[model samples]
Each structure stands twice: as C-alpha cells, then as structure tokens.
Target: MSTEAKRPPVPSPSPSPAAAQKRKEKGTPGDNGADAARATELAPTTPGVRRELLHSMLLQRRFEERCAEAYALGKIGGFCHLYIGQEAISTGVMSMIRPDDYVITAYRDHGQALARGVNPRSVMAELFGRQDGCSGGKGGSMHIFDAKTNFLGGHGIVGGHVPIAAGVGFAIKYRRGNQVCVCFFGEAAVNIGAFHEALNLASLWDLPVIFIIENNRYGMGTAISRSTANEDVLVRAKGYRMDGESVDGQDVFAVRECMARAVERARKGKRPTLIEMRTYRFMGHSMSDAVSGTYRTKDELEENMKRDPILLLHNRIFEAGELTEGEMHKLDDEAKAIAQDAWDFADASPEPPLEKLYADVYADTSS
Candidate 1:
C-alpha cells in the first residue's frame, strides 16, 4: 500500500457521509474541508443541475441492475462489465463537456455512453444483440458505440483506446477546433505500454485531452497493491511532466470540480492532464466472476458500498433542499421506468439479419 517505492504521494480521499449532511446546517456546504472547497468551486450547481445529476446516476444504476437480470436470463452474452458504483464520475464529467467534445473509454462503458446522451433504448438493444442497436447488434455490451453523439466506441483491450484518444485530440488541434477529448480507463491500464506512449505524445504536442484513470482498487480480481510498484496512478503523470491530480471519485462535487479544471485547460489552453479517480466497484470484475468475497473480503465490499455514489448524492439532495423527498422519489421512479422501457424496446426490436454478414467489413475495390 506504500506507493513511496516508485512515485510521489497522491492523496486518495474516501467517501464522507458527514460532507453530504453538512451544507444543511450552516456556513459551508459540507463538513469535509475538501468537499467544502469543491462546493465553492462549483458554487453555481443549481436545482436543475442537481435533479439532472440524480436522474442520470439513478438511470445508470437501474440499467446495470437490469443488465444483471438479462444476463442471468440468457438474453445477453459475452463479457458484460457493470458501472454500478462508478456513476458519479461519468455523470459529473459528461455534464461538463459539450456535444462537440469527444469521449472514449474502455469496456466498462454502459454508463459513459448513456451519460453522453446515447439513447438507453439503443444501448439496451445493443446489449440484447437486436438489429436496432447503436452498433447494429454486432458489438455487444463491451463495444457499445454512437458516433452521432461524439462518443467513440468502447474498446475491449485495456489500453487500446488510449492512443486513439490522443489521435482524436490531435485532430481537434489540427482543425483549430475548441473541443477536448476525454479518455477514460482503469488503474490497471496505467502499466501498459500504450498508456505511457499516449501520455508522452499528448504532452509533447500539447494536445487537448484528459486522461482519466478510474482506480477502482481492483483490476479484474487482483488489487493494485499486488499488481504494480506504484499504487497511485497519478504519480505516473509526473514522469510525463503532465499536470495531474487525484480525487475522491465517490464524491460528485469533487469529481466535477476536478474535471471542470481539466476541461478548461484542454478547451482554452492546449494542455493534457492525468486524473486518478479513486473509486470502488460494488460488484465483481464481471458477472461471471464471484462477487462474494472470493478475492476481496465481505467486509471490504460492504465498507465500499457504504459510500455508494448514488446514495451520497441523494443525501446531498435531501440536505440542500434542492428537491423534496417526494420529488426525489419521483425522479428515482422515472429513472427506473426508463430502464424498464429500454428492456421492453430491446425485446421488441428485431435481431440482426443473416444476409448482412459482411456488412461494413470490406471496401469496394472497383473504384
């Protein structure tokens, strides 16, 4: 657990229940000093924004919950990774970016695509392998894509998309466009060759991209302490001489504040950043894997769930008077309904036809 072996110390803040309840009392928004600082930095988070955040996170949570059911019912196949606990990071970061901006991530991307405005119906259709899926039913849960929303497809390989994200950033710079590319990946990917290569090139060219490392403590089933010398992924940024920061990934306000700064730096100035978000997944690496304390202890799992991002945000909503309990419950119901509707729509949609087996595979040689 001591990262002093190879890298500088990076602070990883855990979730705080006290912070969510602090704003209701008096002078500051949250009890935690860091949380209060974040609240001030994002002071303009209005009632509408709060509602949207809650709604988006809830929808993601419920959708994944449904995915688990579908997978069990033999409706979906192949690798299916859920984003059940890491919703706040996606929701908060996506809210800060524009439609023109680009977004890309690794396979655990159902929530990321939805946050980027990809229709849940199409996403569910993709999961169900229906013809109307965003990827025409070819790409399953791991490869959901929607170019129309500027959300590049999710790659299956760990660091495969890192270089591609750098290329996207380069394209924006070449065209003199005011858009930033946000590349997301797990902490495990930081050890890969492509990750360092992409960071070095991006920093050298001053490309507009934010390299977000979602450090969920485990890469598949192995914890970070067992994998690499440096436990803190942000310290890797120091080698590339890129500005980097680590934050409490479970806290939405903290994530938003950190991401807001990264976005500004990418959009205005051509500066790339490396962000290490310390979050934890409530479930196992994948549905096929055992989540019942096989590699991790039951106590560890329960302790992390206590800081669930959706519950944290809900507590803040109740504390701040942004929305009444009844209204929040109504929003939660709406989110659940959306997920259910997606399932129904996906069920009704047709399957991919056999005739189009070679569709989009090869180009015309006659030209």
Candidate 2:
C-alpha cells in the first residue's frame, strides 16, 4: 500500500435529520428524494456519479432480503450471508474503481458482486442454484464470479482469498497495467497467516493492492475485543512497513474518500494500503444467525443503527432542499421493480443440464 503522505484525509460531513428519518423508514437514502438529490449535488466532488450508489446498495439490500425469504421457503439452499448493513462499504469503495479493476472478497460477497455490476438476475439464479447463475450453478451464495466485470470468485475459507488478491495485484504489476486489485475481508482475517504473508509480499513488490478490512466488530460469534489483542486492524500494517488507517465504514462519503486515495496511490505504482473500516452488520453472521436479539444485545445493535449510512446521506440531501418526497418514492418503486424482475427471471430459469456437469470439467480427446 502507499504511504500516508499519498493517502489524503477524507472530509467529514454532518448528517441531516430528514435523511435519518428516511433511512429509518426505507433502509436507504436513495429511496428519499432529498437524499438522492443531495447525493447528486455532491457528485461534483466525485464526477459522473449520481444516485447509482444508493440504487445499487438498495438493490443489494432488497436482493439479500429476498434471498433470506427464499432460504426460509426452501427456494434457495446452502449458507446464505446477507450484506444488509454493510452496503456503504462496498458501494462507497467500488464507486471509485473502474470496470477493469479487480475485486475479490470472502463469502459475505453479494454486495460487492452487485456493486461490481454483475447481473442481478444471474446472481439471483446462482443463489437459486440454477444454470443461469453467474457460476452456472457450480458456486452458490459464497462463489459468484464475472470475468467480464473482473469480479473474482467469492471464497469460502476464512481469510483464504487474501493471497489470491495479492496475486491479482502482482499480475497487474507484472503486466504493467495501471489496474489495481481490491481485497475485501473481515476483521477476523487479520489473525490468519494469509493476511500477514499477503501484506508482506505486496509491500515488498510495491504491488497496487488495497486491503480493505470490513471490521464489523465480530468474527462469526466472537467480537474483535475478544479474538485479537489489538482491535485496531490498521495498526497491523506497520509490521509490514505499509500505510494503514481506520475509517467510518458506515459513512458512504468517508469510505469513498478513503478509497479514492488508495486507488490513486495504486494507480501511481505505490505500495499497498491497509484500510480498516469500523462498521457493523445489522444481520447475523449467516442466515442461521438471528437478526433479533440473540448473540448481541438489542441496545448494542440499536446504538449502531443510529449511525446508519443511508440515513446520514439522505438527511444531508433533505437539509440542502434538493428533492421531493414523491421523487424518492419513485426511486424506491423502481428499485423494487428491478429486484422483482430479477427474482421472476430466476424463478423461471431452468437448472443446468446433467451432462453439463461433466462437459465443463476438463479438456478431453474425441471419443
């Protein structure tokens, strides 16, 4: 990762109350007119970007919500991890990258995959384990891959994808391309050996890899305070002689700002940077985990909810007097319609043919 001097400080913006109210009601600011407009107004800070971030995040949240329901109804099988609250982290960071840039992450990857522009219908079909899935039904919720979009497969092993991310960065450097590789993992991954080894190699080669640790406070059931001696994940980068910093992952602007610097550094051929996003997950670790009060206290979850990223952005837009309530409703309706279309498509899609399982396996001689 690049050094601190190359990584600029992100500007902090105040949240608006109107945006908060909208977020509380709709789970996103883009669903509210004021919030969407405010996001548009701020587009100048990040050119050519409009309400897509909000729309994409909302799509992810809705898609995952449908998956949860499907899992319950037995329409989808296997371990399903919903990226409900962590939408901003992926959306904010991904907004800064180009289509050619690479993205790799762990099993909690639906949000990242969607943000990277994978077809929602294919993703949904994959969750349904259908032939139309991004992975042709071979990989489920934890393994979505779209080569055209440069989204690598979602790995299942804890911290297993770190080295793969570094390898992608090395490839980019060797090819002499300006592309950067983004490696997204959980805070628990820092304890794994892959994290250390990947960082060491990335730093030594000055590879353009950005290691983003989505520290949602818990590694499965264990909290950061319990699993590791140092809860500040960014501090670990010092050991590898790399630049690292912590950011408010819940805030879209904060994450976007941080990613902009990291992307710039990577494009400039600087070393990798380790960014620890201090965020939380509104849902359980997996579909098996309870969203209500179980592993964590209600108060603890409630406190985190107060800092909702969707609401913060919406309120800022409302306070700026940019959009109307009716407009926000239209956006929400559009997102719902899009999600519904994808679900319907997945429902109607056929499963993979039995022979296909053997066909794509390996090259063979004529019989």
Candidate 3:
C-alpha cells in the first residue's frame, strides 16, 4: 500500500477529532437563461470583486490545463489530481477568508494553494519536483504546503486531513484567535470512517472549521452513488447537530457568500459548518485516466462544459456591461503569461540536492 493510504489516524489537538463534508446536487446542470440568472444572483458585487475572482479562476484553469499537457509528457510524478472544473469553489472560498485564516485540503489542491496566494512559479516548480518547490521537491503534486500562507498541506490521504483541520481550529480557539480553517476534500471521502469521527468532534467542540466537499460528481473513477447511500452528503451533518448547506460550486459568488457566512460563524464561536459544492470535473480523475473508462460519458462531459464556470462568470459580467470582452481577453492573456513563466521557471530550476534528503524526514530530536 502507498504511504498515503497508511496515514495512521493520529490524535488531533481537539478534545476529539474534527471533520465535515458537502456536495451541491441540484441545479439545471446547464448554462442557459435560468442558470445565468442564478449565477447573477449569487455573484459577489463589490469594487473589483468580479474581476479579481475571474483572474483567480483563470490562473488556476490555465495552470492546470498546462499541467495536463505536462503530465502527458511525464513531467509530474506520483498521483497528480487536477482541480480543473472545480475552480470556483477554491477561488471564492479562499477570497472570503482573512490572511490569518487557515486552509487544509486533500490532494486536488493546486487551485486552493494558488487562490491563497502561493506564486504560480512555486506551484509549478513543486509539480516539477524542483528544489525551489513549495515542499522543497520532497512533495510533488499531492503535497504542496506553504506555512507563510497557512495552507496547511496538500495531503495525499483521502479523509486524513479532515481531523487535522479540526485540530487547527481547536488551536485557534485555544489561542482565542478568530480564525477559520477550511478543509477541502472529494465526495468519496464522506465514506471514510475518519470523516464522521472528525465532523462529530468539530461539532462537539465548536471548532471553527468549514468542511467543504468539492463534489465533482465522480469520486475518482467511481460515481458518488456507487459508494455513498446518501446522495445529499450534507445530511451527514445532521448526526453531528451542525448546520449544513449545498451551494452552486460553479458560481463563484454563490460560493463566496456561503464561505463568508461560515467564516463569520467560525471566527465568532468556532462552530463548524458542512457545505457541499455541486460541481463537475472536466477532466478525468487524473492525467493517467483522462477518460474515466466506462464510468462517465462524452455527452455528459459536453453538457457540463456548457456551464463552464470560467465562461459562465465571464459571459455574465460581459452581458451586464460590468466588463467588456476586451478586458476579459486581457485577463485571460495575463493568466496564460503567468502560466508560461511558471513552466519556464520549473524547467530551469534544479533538483533537490542529496544532502537534504533526510533534512525534514524525521521529527526533531532537540529538547
């Protein structure tokens, strides 16, 4: 078994383990009049909020699209999960949090880390396993971490980080700091035993953590229905007595609004909220399985693309005269340039030296 699968459930800082999950299940599942109206209603409206949101999503999109191409060419190693279609969830939620706030997520985390302000080059370098990578070339795609930004990790374990996030929330409460910890994971994680354990603890202790389930329909190659009995995963929250919600994951504004409320509640009283973002994955589970074999279909993929979050937000703003086609074109171009620079940096960056192999491998022996 892989090391990730062996993540022994360690004791969390909380009196008990913390956890939560969400998957947005209802929507027209199409990009049309009703869908457009829904998006408009949910969009964030403030000075430059729309533009910046678009920029953040665009950066993640372009970066991962290139990552797909690079993975096909064998640049990234280990299990590389892409966050292509789920861009809005990270972009919106991360935008709503304060600098002191914390973020912890499962392996599909490039977008969240970038949304939290990890430089494009550093992210790309990590994927390339270069010395300057965020995890210093030790952790490739599935282990990105940046303490300066409080992005706790890009954990490879499925439901492992759920409780760890609760621990962070407990520490925040212990310090009396009004900060929230947002834990991101896939729909499949809901089935893990550790998931329920964490959520129960989060509620019992009122740890300020938002358990975000980025339900992109399929839990890897298997659909949620195959493994989970409850289609609406938020129902799991009821057992813990914590309020839960399902949001339009593709609509950035909708996600931001939900995140804003959850962050406020956590910062104020350290209560945890469960949210499921209804979204889709344009790509397969990973670059290796780009098609997902017989699990998903081409027509279904085409249909979801109609409501592509990037285009949905762009068209909505342009139609309302909030932004022009020229402005959006410029933003898209800038994202591409940033991605190109990241590629260049990763290509030129050197590999980690052998001397540092055991540098951070073990616990410190110091007093």
Candidate 4:
C-alpha cells in the first residue's frame, strides 16, 4: 500500500452553533438559489471580473493545451493530467473563498493550483522539473504547493488529500480562526475508504471543511456507474450525516452560489458539507490517454461542450448588456498574451540549484 493509503484518519472536532444555524438555513427553499444569484450580482461590476474569470479559465485551458504540446515534444516529463474543461469549478469556487482559506486537490490539479493564485510560470517550471518550480521541482505535475496562497498541495494519490484538508480545518478551529479548507476530489474517490473516513470525521467533529467532488463521471478510464453502485455522488454525504447536494459544475453561477454557502457555513464553524459538481472533461483523462477512446463516445463529448462555462458566462454577460463582443474578444487577446508571457517566464527562469535538493527535505535535527 502507498504511504497515503496507510496514513491513519484524523479525528473530528466539536460542532459549532454557527454551523448548525447554517445547516438549518440551507433547508429553506430558494435559499441556495438566492444566495447563488446574490453571488453572481456581487461579482465585481467592472468588466475586469468577467474578464478575469475568463482570462483565468483561458489561461488554464491554454496552459494545459501547451502541456499536451510539450509532452509530445518531450519538454515535460512524468504523469500529466490536463484540466481542459473543468476550469469553471476551480475558478468559480476560488472566487468565493478568501485568501486565508486553504485549497487541496487531487493529482489533476494544475488548474486548481493556478486558480488558487500560484504563478503559472512556477507551476510550468515545476512540470519541467526545474528547481525554482513550485515544490522546488520535486513535486512535478502532481505535487504543486504554495503556502503563501494557502494552496496546501497537489496530492498525487487518489483520495489522499482528504485527511490533510481535514487537518487544516482542525487547525483553523483549534486556533479559533475562521478559515475554511476546500477539498477537491473526483467522483471515483467517493467509493474510497479515505473519502468516507474523512467525511465522517468532519461531520462528527463539525470541522470547517467543504468537500467538493468533481464528478466528471470517470475515474481514469472507468465510468462512475461501472465502479460505484450509487451514481448520485452527493447522496453519499447523507451517510456522513451532513448537507450534500449536486450542482451544475459547468455553470459558473451555480458553482459560485454553492461555494458561497459552503464557505459561509465553514466560516461559521459549521460541520462540513459535501458538494458534487456534475462536470465533464473535454480531453482524455490525461495526456497519456487517447483523445478518441472507446471508453467514451465523441457524441458525449460534443454534448457536454455545448455547455462550455466560458461561452455560457460570456453570452450571459453580453445578454445582460454587461459586455460587448469586442470586449470579449479583447479579454481573450489579453488572456492569450498573459499565457504567452507566463510560458516565456517559465522558459527563461533558471532551474533549481543541485545543492537545494537536500535543503528542504527535512528539518534540521542537529540544532
């Protein structure tokens, strides 16, 4: 067994009155929608808000697209998971979180790392195994970390980061702080022992954690239905005795609203909540998988593409008279320029020094 799988589960903390109130409020009809709409409205009225979301999503899309190109060119090594179509989940959720909150996700995490404010150049350099890369290039594609931004890490093991997220929440609560931890995992992880163990601990102790399950319907090549008896990922939360719901992951508005509620609840010291985001992956599971695999039909991919989060948000902004087509194009151009600059920065940045390798591995025992 891997070290992650062998790690013992952490115990849950005591419940808070604020968390209980939040749960009671969630039961009210239209509460979730009202909150979501408010979030959409609260989103900065300046053109930059939409532009920023769009730019961030586009940067993620293009960055990964470039990763695919680099993988073919042998510029990047090791396992690479592309977040081609799942940009909205990270961007929308991160928007609702304060900088103090923590973010932890599974190996498919390049996008989450970027959305959490990690520099694209550093992330790319990490992928290139450069010493200056995030994690000192030791983590590579699966282990990006930025303590400054509160992004705990990109855990390579499936379902491995759950307990760590719980620990962060525990720390926040122990210190009498309001910070929340957002744990992102795939639907496949729902069936894992770690998922259940972490959820149970969070609920029983009222830890301030938001469990986000990005249900893209596939765990690697296996579909959700094939691996688990229950296809409704959110329903699993009930077993933990916590509030859980499914949302349209591709819809930025929907995700924003859900995250707001979750974050607010966590901030108030409420027990954890489970959210299953029903999204899809535009590309294969990773750079290694064939684009046209027998596991998934192209028609399915085409159908999901129709609900592209970027296009949906852009059209909504235009329809609401908030932006013009030219403005949208201009935003796209800016995003392209930023992505190019990030790539250039990564390419120009010096690799980590060889001596640095033995530096951060462990604390100094001699002292």
Candidate 5:
C-alpha cells in the first residue's frame, strides 16, 4: 500500500493458528495456484466477453465523469459519490454473477448498478431527482434501488447494510436456493459491529454470501492506515472462520478471477468469503471534497492515477490482440455517447410529482 511520505507504515495483525495453517495449505490469496486456474473456468475468456467487460468499465467512467459535470451545474443534488477508479472491481465481479443473484452496495454504487444491468438513463434520472429514476427520484444518488434487476439498493449509512445482506443470504438458504448474495462496502465498514456480526452469522449459518470490501484506502477523508490498526483487512475473516482473499482491484481480470472463486464457493457449498479489494478512488469521498481535500497530497494522487483501471485493461487487451487500438477508441466513443444520452434523458425528465412522496413509503397492510 502506497502512503504519504509523512505517514508511518501500518502494521498487520498476525493470523490465528488455524488461519495460518489454512494459508499454508492453500497458499496466499494472490498466488496463481490451482484455485486461481479453476476460477478461469467459472467465467468465459472469449474475446467477446473481454470486449463487454472493457465497454462496461468505460461506460461507468464516462457516466461518472458526466455526473461530476452535472453536479457542478446543479443538475444533481444530495451526497453524490463517483466510482471513478474502482470501475474494474464492479465490472469484473458482476460479469461472473448470474442475473438471479443479489447485489447490494454502499453509496458509491453507480458503477455496480450499471454493471448489474441497471439502465444508465434511469440512474442519471435518479441523480437528477426525476420521476423516471430507478428509485422514482426520491432516493437521489445515495439510494439507487431497482428491484427488477435484483439490485437491493445502495444504503446511505456506513456499515448499516451489512446485516441486511446477511438477511438476504438467510432468505436464500431458507428457501434451499443456490443463489448467492454479494455485499459491497468500504474498508472502513469493517470496523462497524454490524459488519462483524453479519460475517459471523453468515459463516455459522453457512449462508451463501460474498462480502467484498472495497478498500479504497480512505474512509471518506481519513486514510485506512490512520483509521484502523491493521491495513491488511483480509485477516478479519479468521475471526469468523470464513475463507478470505485479497485481489488487485485495478486489474479487471484479477478481480473477476477472485470473484469467480468466491461465487463458486457460495453457490456450490453455501459458503461465505470475505474479499478485500485494494483499490484507489481517483475522486473525493463525495462531490463536497473535490479531488480529495487536505488528507492526501496532489503528488500522491498523480502517482496512483498511473494505474487507472480502464487504461490498465485497455493496454492488456491491446497487447493480447483481442482488440485494436482504433476499436478501443471507438468503444470509448460509444461509451461517451451512451453517457451523453443518459444526461440528455435526465435533463428532459420531470421532477417527482407531489403525490409520489407518499407512494412507496407506506405499505398496504390491508391487502
């Protein structure tokens, strides 16, 4: 992990005896062992699938870039968090899951929503507080919900939704269903009591849930090293007796491979796995903190930007001869066009009607 020159190195907690033994038997998380190779079979490596993944990441980048512009123009309101550099994690993981699977994420969720097949236009409309939004404009930015796509919704509270994810997994197990539930939250959420509780139950009950920590290194404005004792978060899984792994979030293929293994474990064995994705967020915690305020230095940001997820994948696919440079440029252009259309749609969409305030808030228990 790259830290500012002034910061001290963060210490890692020693894993328990059992956990150490398991690590010895299975090797480290990022090792390209038999499990890693098996993960490849879980996801298609066809050129077409590769192109789709790249396009998804590009579309998310363009969409978030446009969202930033809209927020500056006062077209969007509320706490808007852009998933700029963490696109690869969402695009890669969502690619390996089935439509019947469940996905729940934190406030930085536009990327996951789009990756889960939620319409970009509806997502933009939600940001614009328009009637056509997935959440009917009421859940602007932070609470994008779409039941049709099995995207439970983006929770506003930090670590509050962790237990909810466990509940979803419980429901699946109760039904004797093979579906898996993937919960995404920031690294800071690991500190929350509910996060630990959820993981414990998910393991004890043998729930099919994959807990993914988007360790962007910063909990809002504070860096993970400053906030927590151990920056190596994967070790937390030892307490719950669940499998844990770490992945390079910037590499889409690596993200996909790690998720494939987790998904397989969840679907096949009704197991839970905790994944710590070491990624960086190019933007601030929200629109309020532009390019990250005083917590981090400009030079540090620049250094991290060199590993821009989209650019990394672009170079890889180009070198593999799966896509031409010209074709990649065209795909980027297409992504931009899609984002443009979403913006236009949001601009033309009407605000929520006064009657809609009471629409979904109350349940019709009389029925």
Candidate 6:
C-alpha cells in the first residue's frame, strides 16, 4: 500500500522540549538545531549506513532461518515464531530510535529484540531454555526480555502488552523524559480491547508512543481480510484522533522514512501515531504451523516470497551503488556465522536449575 495518503504533518527536527529549555536557559543554540535538522532529514542514507542496514536485515534473516532449523531439530521448543520475511520493519524502525527509548512487541519478536540490540546469544539461549538466556530460559520464545536495553518483552498474550506500553509512555511523560515507546503487534491484536484502550489513552494523554501494526496478511490460520471488518487497519487510528499512515514493510528505506517522521512527531510532543506495515511472513505463524497451510495456498506464499524484504533491500543497495552482489554474499555469510555462533553458545549453555524455577517469580514486596 502507498504511504501517500492521510499523512501527518512532519514536524521539523527540532530539539526535544527538555533540550530546547536547557539551551534557552544556557542562552545558546546547543549543538545548533538547524544543522541537526539537516542531518535528520533522512537524506538518502549514506552508503556505509545503507550497508549496515542491509547487514542487520541479513543477520535477522539468517538468525531466524537458523531458529527454524533449531526448532526442527528440537533444540528450540515451545511456541517459536519466526520473523522470516518481516525483517525490514524491525531494522528500519530500530534504526530511527535512541538507546534510551522503549520497545515492546508481540510473540513474533526475535527480529525486534535483535534490532533493539539484545544480544543474539542470550536470545538463542532463551529459545534453548538455558539458564543464561535473556529471560532466564523460563519465558521461552514468546517472552524474550532485556531490561538493560529497555526492550520490555516479547509478550505472549495477544494485545496484552499494549497497555503496558502505554504505561511506559506515561512514565516517560511523567518523568519529563524525551523517550518514545514503539509498540508492535500483529494485525489481529487491533481487534482486541486492550489495543483500542491503549491507543485511546496514548492519544488522550499525549503519550509519546508509536503503535505499529505488522499486517502480515494472516492472524494464525485466518486471513486478516476475513478476521477484521475493514482490511485497512489504518482507519482505526482516526477514531482515537491519532495520526495514521501505511507503509510498504518490504522496503527498508520506506519503513525508515515513515518511522523517522513518526519519531520526529513523538519527540516534538505530538503524541501517538498508528502505522500499518503491509508485509508478509514466509513461514507459518509458529514452527508448528505449515508454511503453506490450508488457509493459504502454496502459490500465495511463493508470490509473497518474491518481495522478500531482505532481497528487496539487497537489490536496492546494489542498484544504489552501496554494495555489490559479491559483498552482499559475504555479509550473508558473516550473518550465518553469527547465527551459528549463537546456536553453539546456546547449545553449550546449561539449562535452568530446579532452584531457578522459584527465582523472579515474586518480588520482595516487604521492603
């Protein structure tokens, strides 16, 4: 879908309120906001940066492919969802955020967690149900969490994390912080009550949050068209009086551009924006589901594969003179190596001990 319609007014890349106030009090243009805006304009990304973007996407692709293999081999167990074809969305959005900002997502979260800088070893370890895992192996595939990175979690309950994301945004606002919370969920979650409640509060409270709908065409076994009354999820944002737009998630550049504008709006205190990313998943909803199941035919899966996000970025970078095909292949090999290293680490890590079952289950409330 084209991102040309219902676009919000892009805010100038001005400093955050706190930064502007600080500069005003200091009686100086701290770091020169104009120059910052020029750099912030998303001018065709530098070739080096583009290469890095491609590399990140390649890493995610290889990582998830290895995850599938691990799942098949019984190395990874319990509710594993692979982000095979939706790499661009995570890489693009994550590229635009700061380290201090918050990120939360639904079950299909390996890509987002990795993009948010969660270490691959910990992630793979979590999938392997080992002690050194991010969530200490108890959370399994759907509960990847890293507080150090401010990555809230890979929530298992559909739409459950929406309200939690709102709480994070509220905390930022209450603390007078400039951080934005990017909340991601599948198209199915939009129908849930919590998703709507969160959006309404995010808009009404003026919370800095970007609600991203990864519309991969299917929610479990049902097509989104069959599940929702209106296939266009962007329209729902209007009811909450929030900015809404659609982007082609297959193209990393497009995702980055759209997210940049949204980030700017959030930083400028414009509150929430709902973005629908039109993408597809090459694999099943989980490792248990068939790639081309009864709900979707083989032809549809093959057709969508042609627009694979990683390959799209690969060709784009090549056409833009950023990296040659040979260099791309080398990067892919490096990504594979990284994934392999993560697997080896996870395989060697010990499983959580019996005593670990009681840890983190309850907080010390007596204090």
Best by TM-score: 1
* CA lDDT scores, all candidates in order: 0.84, 0.79, 0.80, 0.77, 0.84, 0.83
TM-score of every candidate: 0.91, 0.87, 0.88, 0.86, 0.89, 0.88
Which pairs clash in model 3? 18-198, 19-198, 19-199, 22-275, 22-276, 23-276, 24-277, 24-278, 206-270
Regions of model 3 farther than 4 Å from truth: 1-44, 363-367
Task: For residues 1-367, write the lDDT of model 3, one tens digit per residue.
Answer: 2432322121111111111001122223433455545545544465387888888998898888778767766788777888877888999898888888899999998999999999889999999999889988888899989999998999988999999998998898899888889999998999998899999999999899999989887888888888889888999999899979898898777787787778777877568999999998887687667553478987888777656777656655564567665666788889889998999999889999999987987888988
Ranking of all predicted structures according to TM-score, beginning with the best and ending with the worst = 1, 5, 3, 6, 2, 4
Write down the worst ten-residue block by lDDT for model 6: 6-15
Identify the runs in model 6 with alpha carbons over 4 angstroms from their true place. 1-43
Alpha-carbon runs more than 4 Å astray in model 5: 1-44
User: Model 1, residue 260: displacement in angstroms?
Assistant: 1.0
Model 5 TM-score relative to the real fold: 0.89
Q: Indicate the TM-score of model 3.
A: 0.88
RMSD of 2: 8.7
lDDT of 4 by residue, 138-205 (tens): 88898899989999889988888898888888898899898889999999998888888899899988
- What value does the lDDT take at residue 334 in candidate 5? 94
Mind giving the per-residue lDDT tens digits that candidate 5 earns over 1-367?
A: 2213211111111113354345435533333345335546665477788789889998898888888888877899888998988888999889989999999999999999999999999999999999999988989898988998899989999999999999999999999999999999999999999999999999999999999999999998888889888888988999899999998888777888888889989999899999998888888888888574499888888767656777666654664567765777789889989999999999999999998888977788996
Supply candidate 2's per-residue lDDT for 282. Answer: 80
lDDT of 1 at 104: 96
Off by over 4 Å in 1: 1-37, 363-367
Clashes of 1: 0
lDDT of 2 by residue, 315-367 (tens): 54545455455555565567668778888988988998898888667777688
Steric collisions counted per model: 0, 6, 9, 3, 0, 0
Could you tell me how far off, in angstroms, the CA of residue 193 lies in candidate 4 after the best superposition? Answer: 0.5
